[model samples]
Target chain A: MLVNVLNVISQWAIPLLLLIIPLYGFIKKVPVYEKFVEGAEEGFRTAVRIIPFLVGMMVAISVFRASGAMMVLGSLLKPITDLIAAPAEIMPLAIMRPLSGSAVLGMAAELMKFHGPDSFIGRLASIMQGTTDTTFFVLTVYFGSIGVTRYRYSVVSGLSADITGFLVSLYLCHRLFG
Target chain B: MLNLIWLFLLVSGILVAAWHGNIEVVTSAALQAARDAVEVCLNLVGIMALWLGIMKIAESGGLVNALARLLRPLMVWLFPSVPPDHPAMGAIILNLSANVLGLGNAATPFGMKAMQHLDQINPRPGVASEAMCTFLAMNTSCITLLPATIIGVRASFNSANPTEIVGPCILATASAMVVGMSVDYWFRRRNRRRRR
Candidate 1:
């Protein structure tokens, strides 16, 4: 019941905002189109500005993946995962979640396809993917856009959250769906 | 730290590839990743323009500020470094709201806008301010109410109940948020003391 309500809200949210913002602007005698165009000009510049940062971050991530480092890491971490009774298949998803968004999403879909979405692995993967954002990508784009080279402890904080999310997802999935 | 991670990825990747005799794969992956990065940025341009334009209109109509005011107390508490009436507060609020609603595309532009606003007030150029770090922490681990894309992916996989993970997802995300905020707070205090 709650999911249905959230689904409707998520679907309608953008369209509603698109309508309401301009309509409200028009009613308030604001030149909505002109303002929109002015703001949009920055969009092009912002996208261009983050190009170097994105390339640097993505190349490293891709190289890491292409070199089969993740698989090695997964194997190395197998003992702990086994001890916790978590499937080895889900380890790659957890490791990749904070590094790259698309990579983890692809893994989650593949897991669901291979294991069936109702299976424990599929459900666990789904929750893990949903609960965590791509920390490295976010840090790169957001901080890079503003040229913030000294991010201080942002990385530490983000990874801590991601780790917490992973553990919580594992525990919750086991209790709820196992 | 980012410097360390970048070096670690590159160094470890190359070493691992050499160990496995897969150096060519790493080389090709690097080139492909660079190209894909540009593609991702270009794709973002249109959506960024659309959202930024809408946001511009909202700002002009005072809607952004009004919305910010509606949640003034919460905004103040979350981002004390920002003035309650500042445009940064509004943009940050919009970004978080979009994130909560699972509007990833909308959230990005709003987040960029917020960062721009936050940067304007930053005393140190090229350094993340306290508010920026706090914002990033919250953003990277925000409580997700609707993980729309994941649900769609599950449904496409023929799950009997695609939304079954929603409750668990929310619980996990909420716990993540709590920890993220706490860690960010602790770091902020430590940094301040060191600076003093």
Candidate 2:
């Protein structure tokens, strides 16, 4: 019963925001169409700028996967993650989570295919994907676009947060679904 | 740091593939990944345009400022270096709120704008300011209320209950946000002490 309500809310959340914000703009007598076009023009430019970074990261991820490096890394980290009650199969997803969204999305799809989306590993992967942002990607594109060279402390905090998210996802999945 | 990671990924991947006699796999993968990258960017274009357009209307209508005002107290505490009335503050607030609402595409433009605003007031041109680091930390660990993308993927995969992970996602993100903020605070304090 509770799940149904939350699901409904989540479904409506984005649509409502899209509708209400524009309505609010109209009410305020703003030139909504012009402003939207202006912002979207910037968005198009930003999207173009991100292509190089996206390709670089994606190619690297592909190499990591095709070369079996991802599996090897996952194996190497298995004992440690297992000791902490995390399934080793999902380790690569956790590592890739903060790096590239598309890479991790692909990983999640693979995991769901192999383990079934209802499986514990699949659930954990889904939660991990949802909870964490692409840290390195964001830093690169956002900071790179603005030319912020020295990203002191940002990487540390970002990765730490990712670790926390991973651990929490594991714990929550185990407790809630296991 | 990013350079090292990139280098490691490329070298290790190629080395490992060579050792396994699967060099062809690496070649094919790279080509496929390049194509995928273009596809991903193209997918983002529509989403980005839609969200950025909506966000612009919100900005012009003063909705962003109103939302920023509501979040100002907490934001001021988080970004002490930034003035209360600064555009950066509003941008950051809008970015975070967008993120929380699971508007990743919309959030990116706002986040980019926030970074630009933060950069305008940055004392050191190239070096990231304390405020920027804090903002980045928060952005990276922004608490997500709805894992919309994940749920959609799960549904596509025929999960019995697609939204089952949502509860856990929120909890996990909340924890991440707390840890991120704490680490940012620690780093800020330590950096200040070093200067003294």
Candidate 3:
């Protein structure tokens, strides 16, 4: 029941916002069209500016992935997963969650497909995927956009969040579905 | 920091690929990712323009301010460095809202706008501000209400109850947000003390 409501809300949200923002602005006597064009003028420049930073970040991440580093890392961390009695299957998803959003989603889908979405591993993967943002991507894009190279504790805090999210997902899934 | 991570990723990746005898794969991946980066930016230009333009109308109409006002108390607490009436506050609020609503595409433009606004007041050119760090901490683990994509994926797999994970997802993300905010607070205080 709640999911249905949420689905409806998500479906209607963007359309409603798109209509309402402009309608309200127009009602408030704002020069909506001109303002929009003026604001949009910065878009190209901003996108272009992000190219170098994005390329650098993406190449590093791609190289890491293509090197099978995750598999190596997964085996290295096997003892910890074994110690905690957590399913080893979602480790790759957990590790990739912070690094790349699309890659992690693909992992989650694959997990769900192999294990069945209603199974413990599948449900855990689903929750895990939902609970954390792509930390590297966000940090790269946002800071990169503003040319802020010295991010200081942003990364520390971001990784902490990712770790916390993963642990909490594991705990919740175990308690609720394990 | 970022410099170290970048170097580590590059060096370690090549070394690992060499160890695994797959150095060629890493080479292609690097080249492919570089091109994909530009492609990704090109894709973002359209939505960025559309949302930014609409955001301009919203700002000019005073709607952004109005929305910001509604979240003033919370915004003030989370971002003590930013004035309540600042454009950054409104952009931050809009960005968070888009994120909670699971409008990923819409969220990026507003987030970039927020970063720009935050940058305008930053004292240092290349260093991130306290507010920026806090904002990022909150953003990276923001409370996710919909988790729409996950649900859709589960449904596609013919799960008996695809939404079963919704409640768990919310609880987990909320916990992450709390931890993220607390860590941000701790870092902010530590940095302040160090500077003193």
RMSD of each: 1.3, 2.3, 1.2
TM-score of candidate 3 on Cα atoms, chains taken together? 0.97
Shares of reference contacts reproduced by the candidates, in order, are: 0.87, 0.81, 0.82
| Tens digit of per-residue lDDT, candidate 3, span B1-196 | 8889889888888999999987999979999999999999999999889999989999999989999999999999888898888899999999999998888888888898899999999989899999999999989998898899999999999999988888888898899999998999998898789899
* Clash list (residue pairs), candidate 2: none
Tell me the deviation in Å of residue B48 in model 1.
Answer: 0.6
Better of 2 and 3 by TM-score: 3
Which regions in candidate 2 have their CA more than 4 angstroms from the true location? A1-11
Q: Give the per-residue lDDT digits (tens) of candidate 2, residues B132-183.
A: 8998899999999877778888988999988888888889999999999899
The candidate that wins on DockQ is 1
Docking class of predicted structure 2: medium
Which structure is stronger by TM-score: 1 or 2? 1
Question: If ranked by DockQ, best first, what sequence of candidates would result?
Answer: 1, 3, 2
Error of 1 at A155 (Å): 0.3
Candidate 3 — which residues are off by over 4 angstroms?
Answer: A1-3
Better of 2 and 3 by DockQ: 3
Q: Could you report the DockQ of all the candidates, in the order they appear? A: 0.83, 0.67, 0.81
lDDT (0-100) at residue A36 of candidate 1?
Answer: 95
TM-score of chain B of 3: 0.97
Model 3 RMSD in angstroms:
1.2
